[model samples]
Target: MKNEIRVIGGRFRSRKLRFPDAPGLRPTPDRVRETLFNWLRNDIEGARCLDLYAGSGALGFEAASRGASKVVQVEQDAAVCRALERNRALLNAEAVEIVQVEVRRFLAGEGQPFDLVFLDPPFRQGLVVPCCGALEENGWLSSSAKIYLEAEREFRLDGLPLNWRPLRGGKAGEVGYHLCERTFFR
Candidate 1:
């Protein structure tokens, strides 16, 4: 199916992004994205972001549009990666980078710490916890960095990183979205 998702705010407000009909590649809904960005308004400008499991480039592009200095989008599907590249070119999004690699492999490699991260892997694949762990253990996150995680509504937060503190979260139909802060203890 040919489907498109829109950017709800910032420089690219109302921009439509098209994605291939790939299985389990649901983009975060517009309303949810609006809320997520609202939660991130204060911290987003000039921040570095990582969009793990970036299915449709929704969150990554939104972050870039809203003034993020750098946004890295990681997706394993070549087709999706191509689409992401197209979107990046369309927007002349110099700050957005696409990495066509599995999330696991990308996390295993070295990377700079990000101020914000979006994790919306496929539902029911048991990826959230491990991805969160990889971001923490692999030094992909900065201190007190904000992380936005989307999953099945029933998914639990107990498995997330110990230093992560839930800041804002709610369920939207079958989807659950949350904003957490990575805390640092003295």
Candidate 2:
């Protein structure tokens, strides 16, 4: 069976996007998304975004809906990629691009700097830290970029980049969500 998620705010508010029931595919809950967007309200418009491990493309699509100039969604699963493409077409999201590739591979290649990033890798796979590092080291993040991360509630924040300061964070049941800002000290 397929599942659906709605865009909470912006031009596509209330529109629903469908996703396949693939293993390890957990979309960010609406409440958490609302809070994350609120934290980013001042910075989201016209920002370039990267949704790493874009399982359901919820975060990426939401960014586009809220006026992000560019949003790149990277997913490794073929089925999920198809679903994301369908959603993009359904919404006529010309600013949103769906890339079918592993998050690591996508990060390895050079890319334009992003003003915002969403990092919500699969639970229990230990992909978050390395992905954060790659974003920082591989030139994916612009200076002072904002990153939103979701993980198991018990996950620690010690692995995050040293320059990334926690701007806001909280837990919802088993999920931990955080919004961080990169502080360049040079």
Candidate 3:
């Protein structure tokens, strides 16, 4: 059976999205998303966003609903990417783009800096540090970009870029969610 989730706010509020059963495809919980966006209220509008490891495309689509100028959702699984495409079409999300690729490979290539980023990789695989390093080293972040990261509640976000400063964070159940902004002058 397919799993379903709803958009929490903005133009897509209450809209349901369906996705095939795929491993590690958990969508960000609605309450957590609401809090994350609240932390980003001032920065979300008109921002360009990147949703790395775009499971369920929740963060990317939410940014589009809230008026982000552009959003790129990168996911490796073919079925997951198709679901993301379906949701984008369903929402008429012209500002959003879905890419079927490995997150690290995408980051290795030339990057167009984004104003906001959602970096919610799968939990408990040592992905956070390497991905964070790639984003900072490969020119994927605009100066002063805001990044949202989600991981296992016990995961320690060590070895991240020095310039990325934690602005807000909280834990809900087993998930630890955080918002960080890239500082221009470290």
Candidate 4:
């Protein structure tokens, strides 16, 4: 079976993207995305972005539609990657790149700093801390980057980098979303 999600803002607003139904594949909801982008209005234009665990490529595509210079979507699943590719073609998203690799493996390679990152790993996998650490330690973030995190409402931000200052947060039912800014780098 396949599921569909809509891009809620930017040039691709109202476009429908289809994806295969897979375990742990949850696309960020429309309202949540709207709020996140609103919070990033001043920062997103022409920014470089990384979308880890890119499941349905919702956030990444939205960023591209909104004028991000480049958007890398990292997904471990081949089927999902194919769907993302199709969507990229459908939207003529020249700035979006789909990387078919595990998030950690991708993060382990030489890093290119990104101005914004979306880290929405599978729920209940305890991946947030390690991935967050890899992103910082591996130098995948620009000095003043902003990161968007989505997880279960009960999930805490303990163990995250001390410089990741929370800028905004909100909740919708079982999910909690936050935007954090990476402060001065050593």
Candidate 5:
């Protein structure tokens, strides 16, 4: 199995995390994360983020490490939430908020929009498109929001909304990733 890496440019560059054992929770790989953050470098600083399916809080912590002002992490699993909390504490990530709740309910309850959002739900649950729709429907995304998605390589949605342009996409190992930005998300 491959290993995870800390943020390339951040406060916690080499800290280690005891992320979930793979085959159960699939964390985004270091290389893919590096590329994603590179693409997001300009937007991430001081941005508010929403991290759904926040296993291990890797992406959320990375956001905080890279200077995101606030990050809200939503996870349904209790164990994962506890681990995420611990990881955040380890990194002194006061800016990271941990919410132990299902992604759907969380979206339905959101009162604020985010600047950056990361969606890395489990492969088979099929939560990405619906989540995006919910965000759009509830104004949980700013007019200029950006979303980074990672899914099983073969995954595809039937009717992805056209609010954003598909800026970049590719397969990182077995995961197909998407990075898109909103143009007129009204």
Candidate 6:
């Protein structure tokens, strides 16, 4: 994410923070971030947010900026985690926590629930299904939690766990947001 840090839409607009040139770091696009934050603006405030595969801490820091009570980020890549930490500090977002761990392991180890969880694994990784299931088993999500899932537009989600239901999705260039909510099965 060598590109300059750009705030989607808020007080930090046009502010360029340091974004290291790293391969594992693909910051979510501003247009998509803007739409996501807009859709979540009301609920995001005061929410306990979790960001999985938080490369550059974009989503997590954004949550903090928008008034989330606390934001926890998980990223497996060491360099990416470092970048995330730097970005968090640059944004002056002290309410964010960055944990260097694989998405699966973190979900498997989670001991508490979050109000909102953002899961944006790399493209073609097929992480959503197992991650959600692991989250449930590990007590990482509130029963009423909302999960924002993202993937490549062409990725077919035929095997996702029964708990998730697609809410809103649209392609922005090559990436897509597959917003899903926890739903009852049986």
TM-score of each: 0.97, 0.97, 0.96, 0.98, 0.93, 0.89
Tens digit per residue, CA lDDT, model 5, 1-186: 443446555887878777655344878888888889889989988999999888867788889999999999989888778788888888888999999888899889745989999999889777888888888888888889998988899877445677777888888778999998878946
User: TM-score-based ranking, best first?
Assistant: 4, 1, 2, 3, 5, 6
* CA shift of 164, model 5, Å: 1.6
Tell me how candidate 5 scores on lDDT: 0.83
Candidates arranged by lDDT, highest first: 4, 1, 2, 3, 5, 6
Per-residue lDDT tens digits for candidate 1, residues 16-88, read 8888988899989888988899889999999999999999999999999999999999999999999999999
Global Cα lDDT for candidate 2: 0.91
Off by over 4 Å in 4: none
User: Considering only N, C-alpha and C atoms within 3 Å, which residue pairs clash in candidate 5?
Assistant: none
- Pairwise lDDT winner, candidates 1 and 4: 4
Q: In candidate 3, which residue pairs get closer than 3 Å at backbone N, Cα or C atoms, i.e. clash?
A: none
Candidate 1, residue 117: the lDDT equals: 96
Candidate lDDT values, in order: 0.92, 0.91, 0.89, 0.94, 0.83, 0.77
Tens-digit lDDT string for candidate 2 (55-104): 88899999999999999999999999999999999999999998999999
Candidates 1 and 3, the one with greater lDDT: 1
Root-mean-square deviation per candidate: 1.2, 1.2, 1.3, 1.1, 1.8, 2.1
lDDT of 6 by residue, 36-81 (tens): 8887877788899999988767788778887888999988888777
Which candidate ranks first by lDDT, i.e. highest? 4
Top candidate (TM-score): 4
Report the lDDT tens digits of candidate 3 across residue range 56-175.
888999999999999999999999999899999999999999999999999999978999989898888898889888888888989899888999999776888998889889999999
Candidate 4 matches the true fold with a TM-score of 0.98
C-alpha lDDT of residue 179 in model 3 = 87
